[model samples]
Target chain A: MDEKDKEILRMMQDDFPIVPKPYKRIGDFLWMDEVSVISRVVKMMQDGKIRYVGPYFNSAKLGYSGQLMAINVPEDKIEAAANAINKYDEITHNYLRAGEPNIWFTLMTPNEKRAEEIIEAIKKELAIDEILSFKSKKTFKIKVNPA
Target chain B: MKIIDERTEKVLKEFQNNFKIETRPFKRIAVKTGLTEEEVIAIIAKAKEDGIIRRVGIGVRPALTGFGMNALTAWSVPPDKVDSFGEAAAEIQNISHCYDRECPEGWIYNIFTMIHASDREELENIIKSLSERFPECPYKVMETLKELKKTSMKYFK
Candidate 1:
């Protein structure tokens, strides 16, 4: 991606304008036609640089809750544990990290009871009870638009 | 307040992935949901205004770009310093996700920041600078070894 392409990628990170023709509006600012701009975005998407492009919702505002849960898995069992955890529809992000709590994931549920139930279920399934869940007391930042 | 009916919920679920890029994208969405283009657009607008829709924009892979080797760094902050620390941590461009998590016993960390940079060196430098800034507070940087799964949960079944 060239400088101009990067600029376009960066520009698309913001809340897309709510207009009749959103791409055309963006194209006018980029000094390119709507078709060309759309094509460029398509190319970037195919390149795997752009993971997705759609409406990112505020789940909490829409009556949902989330928590960050970390589990300490052995180096060899990491894959097995992740596979088991990922099977749940509630699991959004699961990652292998280097630390005492080797595996980490974030799960969202409709309510506090459901959240606790799911966590307990995972603990029983894995047979590792010490799962440290760190709930956000206050959120300073959440979205990170990578340029 | 905007109403969220079957129409809006359908759009939210069906278009979670593969939001087709086109000249008139909403027209395509309109056809799928059996709604007019204008109605489709209005629903999305209302969702945004209601804060249900955070934003409609591009989502890119950070590691594919210059920003690679992302890690979550935690800082030990006093009760009085959490608000101030969280505010300062949020302002940094490289430091993307920051939050004040619950402070449990045996863990001094209350402030966690997700730092992303082009390479390990850059990430290290950022951490080093942050540590230097707050010499009193000890920090722990947990490196991301592998991504087990990364996907937004589908709100609508």
Candidate 2:
């Protein structure tokens, strides 16, 4: 990734253009051509530097409730618990961090009741109740783009 | 305002599962949704205006960009000051996601901020700076060990 690539990434931080010729807009901004811009994006994806260029939806706006839960798992069983949590599509992100209550995952459900249902199911399946769900009191920063 | 028509739902579904990575990507999505290219753009614009869709960009890995190191740092702030502190943390470039979570029993730290840095020293410095800035709030750090999954939630499924 060179300076030009960073510039492309920085531009990409904006929602990709919704136009038919989206690459053309990016090329115009960077003083390059459409082919080069599209090629670079493809390269970035191939290199594991990017997953994709897409829109980020707001769950709350879509009438869904989201929560960040930290689950207490024995080091030996962390992977199992993570696997179990990943089974549900409601769980968007799952991570293993350093510390007790180490397994972390975020859940986005259609409503508050649905959120409870998923959590209850996990509790029963995992046979654990020492879980803490951090409901969003407020969202300070919703967009954190790496450019 | 949270109403989604069949057409809008179809468009959001396309974005969730398939974000075409080609030039004239919207043209492809337009065909799938049976909307014109212009209509697709207009809907996206309206969604952006409504704050439903945050941003459009390459979903890149931060670690690849040299900001790989990440830690979930929690600060125990007075309930009333959490809002202001959260706002302050959000202003810092390194602190990406900041939130005030419910304090469970035995968990005193209520405010959490995710810090992403390239190295341990940089992350420590940010934590130190944050501590000094919010000295009243005692804090703890949990460095991220491994990423199990990092995909966006697919809605309208």
Candidate 3:
């Protein structure tokens, strides 16, 4: 990404306005047209520089209960397992990490009961014996951006 | 841009509740709020600029999409190096969330990094590199098991 692209990414990573004409507002700030801003964002997504674009809502306030889920899947089956897990809309993000329980993902539901229901579904579908769910007791820090 | 009027407040609250999947949904909201579509657009623009609303988009849970592995790696660094260390940690792509927290007695982990990966091995490799990069500091890995909350702030209330 060039300097201009980096600037665009930086603006995107920070707070993106929730207005209907968000692209236009961004264009106004950057002295570019709304179409150009939209095109750049689309290109960034296509190039894999960004995963997706949209509002990063506060799920907690909406009464959704989520947890960090981890499991140990055989290295060979990691891809397959991840694919199966990704199929669920409730599963927002999944990651591969280096640790005892390598497969990590997040699950969100309208409530704790629903969240557990989704977890049970995964266990049954994946046939995994060991799974760890870490629920946050307190939020120490939660922000997404480059400092 | 006027401090959100009562009608605008009602509209925003509804927007948070009913984020339907359809084109020109804002028009529907405008209909409900008794405002023109252009007014609805303008209010959202002003609220966002004022930092009252962060974004109007999807909220995804990272683990379910195959980015499953994540851990909070804490590092004990000299007071002089904390700022630079945080800057370096923030540059790592996989390290999404980084911050400084007050360390408890006998546990001086002031610098924390949030590392996400597809598996544990990958996460460990990143931590190893981080450890090597900052050999003088001691670190610990705290994995997250549950996410109690994952939403942005809404100041419309």
Candidate 4:
């Protein structure tokens, strides 16, 4: 990406305005025309540089409770375990990380009971003896602007 | 309980990921969600004011971008130090997420921080700097080997 593309990305990460004509507002800030700004954003999206552009809702306010779950899946069973966990749409993020609990994922549901129910199902499906789950007690920061 | 009205839900459901990429994006959304441009803007702007909408922004693919190495480092912070540690970590530009979570039995890591860097060396350096800041708290850097699944939360649909 060019320097101008990078600048546009930084603006997107910081805040894409909520307005009828957001591209124009962004154009006003960067001294570019609305058409140029929109084209660059489109190009970036086509290039796979941009994942998604929209509003990031506060999950808690939306009545969703989330927890971080870790399961120590044996090396041979990693694939099966991941497949089982990934079957649920509630599992938004699943990753294979280096540690004792090699598999970690985030599960968010409408309430704690549903979250627990999914946890139990995963355990049963995997035949795993234990899964370590951590619910957020306090959120200090969550602005994931990695531009 | 659903705090938002059905119409607002419809707007969110449509715009979360499939937001238009045109100059008049909201105008397009208005067309799709059957709301007027002004009404759509009003709902989104009010949601932003109410803190339900964190920001109308873009989520970049860090791994696809220059930032290929990401780690979810868990730290064992004492109750008294968690607030200070969280505040300090949050201030760092590279540190994206910091949270205090309940530790499961036999686990000591309570404070979790997510960091992304361009490479392994840079990730280690960032963790080293964090270690220096909170020398007393031991941490485990769970370097991601693979992203099995990563997607936005589908609240309505």
User: Model 2, chain B: what is the TM-score?
Assistant: 0.95
Worst 10 residues of 1 chain A by lDDT: A138-147
Candidate 4 lDDT over A42-146, as tens digits, reads 999998889788988899998888899899888899999989999999999999999888999999999878887898999899888778999999999988665
Using lDDT, give the best candidate's number: 4
lDDT of 2 at B73: 90
What residue runs in model 4 are displaced by over 4 Å at the alpha carbon? none
lDDT of 3 by residue, B48-111 (tens): 6665555644333456434677787768878787777787787787787666655434556677
TM-score of each: 0.93, 0.95, 0.58, 0.95
For candidate 1, the share of real interface contacts preserved is 0.82
lDDT of 1 by residue, A1-147 (tens): 887677677678867766667778888988988888888888888998887888788877767777788888778887779888998888989988888788889988888888888888888888986688788888898775643
Q: Per-residue lDDT of B42-147 in model 2, one digit per residue for the tens?
A: 8888888887887776677888887889998988999778878998898888887888888677888888888999999999999998888888999989999998
Model 2 score (lDDT) = 0.83
TM-score of chain A of 1: 0.92
Docking class of 3: incorrect
* Cα-based lDDT for every prediction: 0.81, 0.83, 0.65, 0.88
Model 3 misplaced regions, further than 4 Å: A18-21, B1-35, B42-95, B98-112, B115-157
Query: Which tens-of-lDDT digit does each residue in B4-39 have in candidate 4?
Result: 988888887778856888877888879998999999
